[model samples]
Target chain A: MADEAEIFSQLKQAVMEGDEDVAVAAAQAAVAAGVDPQRAIIEGLAAGMAEMGRLYEREECYVPELLVSSEALYAGLGVLRPLVIASGKAEKKGVAVIGVVQGDIHDIGKNLVKMMLEVNGIEVHDLGRDVDMERFITATQETQADLLCLSALMTTTMIAIKDYMPAFKTQLPGVKIMVGGAPLNQQLADEWGADGYGENAVEAARVAVRLLETK
Target chain B: MHRDHSVKGKWVKCDQMTSQERWEALVNRRPTDRVPCLQFMLGHTAVVNGRPIAKIYDDGAESLACQRNAMALYGHDGLIMHGWANAGGAEFGGEIEFPYRKYTGAPLMKKNPVQSEEDAWDLRVPDDILSVGTMPIALEFSRLQYEAGLTVTLQVGSPLTWAGSVYGEERLMIWMLKKPELVHHVLRVITDFIRRKADYWIDRFGAERLMAFDLGIETNKLYSPKQFETFGFPYLREIHDHLTERGTAIILSHICGEQNKNLPLWARLSYGKRGMVSVGKEVAISKAREMFPDCVIMGNVDPVTVQEGTPEQVRMLCRACIEEGKDHPGGFALMTGCEVPPQAPPVNVDQMVKACRELGRY
Candidate 1:
């Protein structure tokens, strides 16, 4: 049997290669070897995702590569999440409610941000795309979410973010609002009163972590 | 209202060139008063007209009015009668949502028709797919715009983009990796349908008068240059060959995101000598002009800046773009990297026109 370090490395390699079966097999083997779930996740899966994120930022990898890697990571997570919870070793950084804002069905960016957040150990409630403003408020209230991440690919749908800011502030005053997408910039985020702006998925996860730390 | 032209610091009556003449002059690299300004401003036009986006998409008359009013307001050289998003996919049984009030949001696919590899076999290109859905409305709008003496550009997605719409993008991504042959099958079907649709339009509207804006070639952002070369270029070549053979003077190619790696392949297009390519914000116009010296480079202005910035800022950006490509031997057109936002300030658009007339002078 391989040692914990070797098993962990194999898991990481699986994720980086975007091979779901290998990731799951390596994860299950690590669990059977009595390797800590948190260690397996952070040192193995999350580490691989971090590398993938770097590749994406450097343009070495594109959206399809990221998508496949995330899918692999989730497959491993599927086999390990309940185990981690049962072991009582799961440490969630924060609870996040993320969605592509009202009238926008473009969710690729939002989906990427969610995957990054999840890999970073944030429990994310994905509201999917074209989400209504009221659903965002309700999800925040129900989940007591620490972060509300809104995404819009189109400039027209982005208006929904601005329209809902006052309402989000009034209703969910403590919730931090994060905005991101192709058309978004830091200046626009400031204009829309977003608590934070993420230019891309990796940056979005970093911003989420920062928002949680400050909270 | 004839705008004054400042040629070498002298105010002169700008030659009243029809939109078509201006486009032709730029394409032919002839001496012109100034660089032409063409915008992908369909959603912005809907906002200017204060019309529901759904109504404009579904009703030809409303779309015509919106396009006409936008030209009247912005004094642009051309107009695009953009139809519902994913109209072809919708015609093939992809469920679509047509929401009102969202000018930028058109009829988007609510459900993809091709769920699995086997589903590709079930898909068929209806004979009247072009006339079905909101396409007829768009065609009618184009006809009206043409009749009104305006240069009408028709925007349609590439086969790969249409395939992604027909089969969900995620599924298509997976297929690209796990089932490439399946992706090829779907792409071939979509290419056939798109080719027929282009032929239909070209036959109805003289190819010289109608410019087919083939979009979605930027799959390079999602796939590698090789993947695009394999799946994207063939269909694009087919359409290009078919259209050019029928005398389509200008075929506008727009790839939404960074396409730096695919620039070489794009330069190899059959009509590269006379066609136009619109690059995204990630590509510099100077670089595109340097690379595709034969093709007319259309744009690189940041649409986000136009949407949120002041008129002065927009003018500054427009001036910068003009300065970058004003001397390119193939010629350049001032345009947004992507569609101008519906809520972009009219003052900013006015400033773009002003910048083109001022700094774009030869």
Candidate 2:
């Protein structure tokens, strides 16, 4: 029988290699070994995903690798997350509402940012793709989210973000707004009154954490 | 020397050659008095013409008229064509929604044709290729281009991109690593469809009059060079070779994003009698010039700047691009790195042409 440290290492390795079966088995082993589910997740599954994110930033890997590794991360989370919740030990740092702005169906970037936020311990409410401004405002208000992240891929759809910003600021006070995508830049985000902008998911997560800490 | 003329109360250099003559000279590798501005424009054309953006994609006659009108309005010299980047979804039996709404730019794939492994295996080229989605409109647009004495255009695929439209991009990408054979199977079908579509266009319009193009998004931001070599390069090479063999006059490939790493593999593909490659701002014009010395380098201007930037800023960038790209061994055309944004200020769009007139002269 593997020790908890060895089991955690196995979980990490499984996710990095994108092997769902190994990830699940290692996670189950952690549960059986009486390791704290939160530690197993943070030290094992999230650790692997963090490394993958770093690799992605360095261009050592690409979207395909990230997609598969995310599958493994989710597979491990499936086993451990429920346990953490049942134990009431899951410590999420902040609440976030994330979505692709209306008329944009390209959600891979949005999805990635959501995953990164989740791994970093944010309770993320994903509104999915082609999300209209009203829905985003409603979700942010309902969740009382600390962060609001919007993504748009096309130049046309990006207009929705700019159009919605004044409303977001007027309606949702104290909520830090972050925007990212292929067509958006820091200058646009700043001009639109967003608190933060990320070029990619890893940076989005980092900025989200910093925003939450500041809050 | 090109003569300077007063137009709209400003001293702008006047073209010694007419647009038609200048375009012909550029294509035949003849010297021109100044740089030509070829627009990679689509949705914006409709905006300028006071029509719904969807008209640019859905109605062929309206699309051509809108484009030609925008060309005249902006004084851009070339690239009068049809089709968008995410093109194959409609032709592959997927449901697509044209951009009728305010924020929609191009057609959106409402559903992907391949939802499962079974669908991937079963995917095939349609028996009636010309009757597929967008084909009739595309043919109509080409017929108009022919009648107007313009270069007839056809949309060929960098098969992997078409496969992404057929299968969802995320699914196709995941399958590349996990189910490579499945990705290859889909690519094979798409490649076959593209070849068949090319043959039909050649048979109808005559290859000499046609400019076949593929909008490739195999950027390093999304794909590694190895992945492009495996999935993007082979199909592109196969298609380019076939088109060249069939005497297609020019092939314009919009290497759509940060594809600096993919340039070597791109360079390996054949371009008919001429090749025109358009790169996004992520790639430097000098690098594009280095990679494809014999092909016309079309761009590196940032589209966001054109839409949101001040006119002088736009002109500054255009002047810089012209200085870098104008002396290429093949040829150079000042253009936006991608589609000029649908809502780009007209003044900003004009700045490109204005820059060519002011500083792009030989």
Candidate 3:
């Protein structure tokens, strides 16, 4: 007997609290009540994730909390995505190809970025870690992505960013390239000809959206 | 390849102080001719020695040669004998893959041993796990460094870090929330393994001769202060107490990434008083010195600058680090924030030593 706004608020609370069962229940309730799937996602799940991002930025929550909240968000999405697709309301904001550069197997940062981007309605094609340069180009060309994001944890692995920037510029002329990781700074990103630099997952998502807008 | 040890550049061999004497003076907060400069340059050493990364990591002779060659090249006061940090997990039944190139950095954990929380129960510290995998390489390298009269610090990964490698970071993170008891159980197993290994090393090298019980996890970046207090602090305290009871003089801890928020928690531990904490590039050395007024502080220099920047830039930064901590009541040593990259310019390292000699004098 809950109203539509009540159901949406429940979904949002479930996500913020990282309760997967409650999130799925709320999503189902929204669907059963004839509430719009897009509204359920944007106003409920995505809104909760945006709040989580703010909490992360303020250091109120850390990686564990962010990760669990993301899991809960995905649980809600699992139920709502099909519904949204069926209703023709599941429009991806932008397409992005992401990976950690070659010689680097540290993918946790990249994984976080991917989740953040997906939660923000960007379609992400993850290439995993230790990805070769050619594989990045292939993924970008195949997906016709709007942006390419690369991550590297070590200075040695980060050299790949500088080495391959020109090649990516020529090969995927239309795609914007963004690089990030512990060892990288904005200066290094600019020096490597990267179009953008994201200090963390939240910023990476924002950068992806901005890149698509500019494109 | 033997080079004469003479007064070169600004670095003069102080005949009055042996390497141990220099280090002891610095640790005891006594004045010395110069502050000791320890180089964590194993990756750079392997590349300069022309050894394959895998061979250098797995073969004792190759690792020793690389360490010795690096000391001769950089003229550092001490050598770090860390063949690879992932070797502990490999010895604990995790599958690891090392790239074939000369400077590919650390080996990868191809397959973790613990697939689920239940699998953690199956993991047991083998009776001779230390001698089985690349650990023997580290032991032999340490033995060689000890015999050569060089100060040697054997680097070991902390329990949570070893467990993460064995169970994967994502799964470990999930377990920390969902199955914390399992995470604690796995940590207990890893702690036992580490204690046994440390005991063996202490028995062989003698506690005083072993420079310090150096533990690295880069835990700060991964866990919040609360989570670290729950999962990381207990094991760290256990290891610290175990080693201290065995007459280990100093315990050095390295935590990578921004650790400004976790410094107070680290300072509160009992063994933290007699130890040195190496913070990453994001931490300001001056602030760390101000915060931990009673502890010896060791680093905050950007490793990337040493790897890619000019020698002059490296020298300037090294000098600035020395200037920041020159007058702290707790002692300071000049070192890279993290491990030096394999491709870090030798000239930059030379400049680091030169800067320490010039600006680090008490």
Which candidate wins on lDDT? 2
Candidate 2 deviant stretches above 4 angstroms = B1-10
Ranking by lDDT: 2, 1, 3
- Tell how far residue A114 is off in model 2, in angstroms: 0.7
**Candidate 3 lDDT by residue in tens digits, B1-362:** 11224444533543345555776787666776666677667667877887666656667677778877777677676645664554456777778777564225878788888986568877788888566556777777778777876555665556777777888888888778878988898889888888887788789888776655444554545678888788877887788778878877567777666777776766665542266777777789978887778767777678999988998889888888888876778777888888888788788888877777666766
- In CAPRI terms, where does candidate 3 land? medium
Instruction: Note the residue pairs that clash in candidate 2.
Output: none
Off by over 4 Å in 1: B1-20, B27-29, B84-87, B102-104, B142-156, B217-221
* Model 1's TM-score against the true structure: 0.93
- Judge candidate 3 against the unseen true structure and give its global Cα lDDT, from 0 to 1: 0.78
List the DockQ of the predictions in order. 0.55, 0.86, 0.55
Q: Which candidate would rank higher by lDDT, 2 or 3?
A: 2
- In model 1, residue pairs whose N, Cα or C atoms come closer than 3 Å (at least 3 residues apart or on different chains), thus clashing, are none
Q: Estimate each model's TM-score.
A: 0.93, 0.98, 0.93
Instruction: State the lDDT of candidate 1 residue by residue for B276-299, as single tens digits.
Output: 888888888988997878777788
